[model samples]
Target: MWQNEPPVAGDLPAEQGIPTLITWNHGGNVVAVEGSWDSWTSRKMLQRSGKDHSILLVLPSGIYHYKFIVDGVQRYIPSRSSFCS
Candidate 1:
């Protein structure tokens, strides 16, 4: 089984101009971020970092909703955001 630190709950405050790193530990072949940051039109592939998966996104300061797509199935990270059907 793959083990990784999940995304922090609530709003994520920006630091400098660096992108925010979001992670998931589903142990899937592919993982991607789908959200308002990209207008929900594309999937930003998350790289496999050790036993976890992560993506770097530089988004504007705002409440942008998002979810993860693991191997073509959508999944939600609890306490982070509601599941988008």
Candidate 2:
């Protein structure tokens, strides 16, 4: 359930960016996400909830590539199955 249409005026503040939720279900004691959004320089840590780890990112509309660092190892998602919109 996601909407591509532009938000109506007043729906959100002009300074706010899109709210994107990133989730990882694979097991790990520590999980983090690094993406092109920050040039892969900032590793944002995800909060663990039950069996999953997730982080909410507020980003501008654009394309980005990301990888998950689970317990100090990097994991990549193949481009063929990646979501781009």
lDDT of each: 0.77, 0.83
lDDT of 1 at 23: 84
Q: Write the per-residue lDDT of candidate 1 for residues 1-85, one digit (tens) a residue.
A: 8868676854466544436778888678788888886689988899997779987777655667889999899999878773222
RMSD of each candidate relative to the true structure: 14.0, 7.9
lDDT of 2 by residue, 27-48 (tens): 9989998988878789999999
Backbone clash count, each prediction separately: 0, 0
Off by over 4 Å in 2: 1-15, 79-85
Which residue pairs in candidate 1 collide?
A: none
- Count clashing residue pairs in model 2: 0
Best TM-score among the predictions, by candidate number = 2
